[model samples]
Target: MNNFTKIQDKLMEMGASFVGCSDVEAYLPENLKKVKYAITVGVRLSDFIIDQISDKPTYTYFHHYRAVNTLIDQITLRGQIEIQNMGYSAMAVPASQTVNDLEDRYSGVFQHKTAAVKAGLGWIGKNGLFISTKYGPRVRLGTILTDMELPIGSHVVRDGCGSCRICVDSCPAMALTGNSWFAGCDRSHIVDAQACSEYMNRNFKHIGRGSVCGICIRVCPKGFSK
Candidate 1:
């Protein structure tokens, strides 16, 4: 097997529910442009915990979210190491982190969703979550940017959320704009991040340190099929 295929297999064995590679040269900053390829890793959240969510996030679901993020980080870190051992450069982006330097407090060092979507693993839902075909928005994602040349998936250029307003209607914060997503669409067209953040902080702070609310994720009908 090729080196990339071997790495992919190893990541799956390490507990990644989904993995994809993407050519994200255009998305990288000037200094980091050398590593144009990205390896995206996703871990499916527990359907039982996600289904337990109603209007607010349960403590169990909150813990599950953090735990899944930690797992994804571990998987991506291992993938990065494996790539480096193959004589290539790699950097594993954190599973979930807010970069203060960016105008968007919700922004990370690199957006995992970007890599995920470009990898054809999912699309951006109206609620601003990565909507996976198999798990809807109930999946935590991690990414490893690398200089290693690997086969990449076809870029998903269109949104899959056609006429679905469940997440928008279910959002207590009224943060969702009910707009469809496109490859280059602005996030403001689909969700009000500030409103979503404030609403969670105001209402569900007692549950998960006010960092989570899963109403939109629970309401999404995609991935519910057995």
Candidate 2:
């Protein structure tokens, strides 16, 4: 097997629900073409998410974000170290990189999502979400940018959402109808960040409060509860 395959297997054994690699070159967002290599990382969610829910101030959903960030941090550090050992220059890019750079230094492309989809980790669902076999759409993602050259993987050719509209029908913000073209804002059918932001801004009781109503997550038959 190639280094990419070996790394992918190693990641899966390390507790990753899914793993994939792609040639960032092909999908190079014009702004980020300077990047020679891109690594996409993802972690599956568990019922641990349910346990972190609260009705208190700020309605913290800490475990989910924490778990995701932890995975991203560990995997990124490990990968970067390995790259350097192999004589390559590598760097970790936070999700915030897109925001920090804004233009020349960054690409509008969300690296994690792009790398994941291109690696065949999942399909870009009609809901505009990446749906993987083990986690459906319940997962957190991150990416790394490097100058390392490695074997590439194929993109997920089949969409898991053959005919499912649960996400569309379950959107509380009435933000979904179809694909990214009509479904909702920012390419997610289940989330209307705008409506949610507006609601959270105006309403007092729930304006700043609990679990962010994951009705779509709860309703997805293919999704995992734990």
Candidate 3:
């Protein structure tokens, strides 16, 4: 098998529910621009745990979210190491992390959803979550930036959300703007990060220290349909 296929297989064997590669040069900062490709990994969340979440976040769902993120981190870190052993440079972005240095408090070092969409694994939902075709928003994503040249999937440039506004209407924080996502659109056009963050902190502190509220995830028809 080719190196790319081998790496992809290894990632899946290590617990990734899905894996896709994308050319992400445009999304990378100048310092890391040399790493032109991104390997995206998604770990599907527990359907039972997600289903248990109602209007508010549940302790079980919160724990499941953190557990899935940790698993994704492990999978991506292993993938990164495997790529490095193949004589290429790779950096695994944290599965879930908030970097305050960015103007957007919700921003991470690298947006896993960006890579996943570029790789055609999913589209961005109105709720600003990565809506996987198979699992909907019921997935936690991870990414590895690499200089290795690998075959990449065709980019999905169009928004699939259409007229759906379930997430927007259901958001207790009124954080979602109900905007359909398109490539290059600002995240604020879909979600108000400050409002979402503050709402969770204020109301859901008992669950996940107020860092999570699964209302949108639970209400999404996509997950239920699957």
Candidate 4:
């Protein structure tokens, strides 16, 4: 009925698995502090492609990964345009772009999981990935920060990965720290980014150019449970 509902409905119609909104003022940089709200969009990855992963990423998985990221970008861009048409300011964060200038080289302009968690769609997994309540870690996220005041999700989902170390044990890079994620906890506590990056670059260059490794996603019990 309202603008938020209209936008959310449109995004879901565009193939997004989930669409959520949250107040993310505290997580913004000074330049983006004006856009205090975030719209979190998630697309569930293919079970067939994800299942193909064992110890390393497959060529098909790499292509699938890029395709999903591109899809997320398109969806968020359309969402951003819709918000602007509604007389609000919006910026679509890239689905997978890394900036070397950031304090964390492995991160994007903003963490999609942060917004997704605040939106109550999911929690951060031990693998440092967003584990959707419905889809587990098999979902990729996109975000659109805006000045619009949208209704936020009330139920903040807690870490459901209690004692699950399957992803940790399965990581060939040994990048996972077996640490559970809590709101506001640093990413390093859960993953060794440098180690993970180096291992992938060294071994999986033929697949996704070492940019992707879905072993953790494949071994995650949460995704296969439902």
Better of 2 and 4 by lDDT: 4
For candidate 3, write residues 48-167 as lDDT tens digits: 888888888889888888888889889988989999999999999998899888876678888899899999988899989999988899888999999999887566656667888988
Model 4: lDDT equals 0.91
Best lDDT goes to which candidate? 4
- Model 3 TM-score, all chains together: 0.96
Give the local distance difference test score of model 1.
0.87
Model 4: per-residue Cα lDDT over 90-166, one tens digit each: 99999999989997888788989889989989888889988899999999999999999988768778788887798
Weakest ten-residue segment in model 1 by summed lDDT: 152-161
Query: Compared to the true structure, candidate 2 yields what TM-score?
Result: 0.72
**Each candidate's clash count:** 0, 3, 0, 0
Candidate 1 Cα errors over 4 Å, as ranges: 155-158
Q: Which digits, one per residue and each the tens of the lDDT, describe model 2 over residues 121-194?
A: 76665454566666776776777666766666554456667677876776555655555322123443444545
Q: Could you estimate the TM-score for every candidate? A: 0.96, 0.72, 0.96, 0.97
lDDT of 3: 0.89
- Sort the predicted structures by lDDT, highest score first: 4, 3, 1, 2
**Model 4, C-alpha of 11: deviation from truth (Å):** 0.6
lDDT of every model, 2 decimals: 0.87, 0.59, 0.89, 0.91
Candidate 3 regions off by >4 Å? Answer: none
lDDT of 2: 0.59
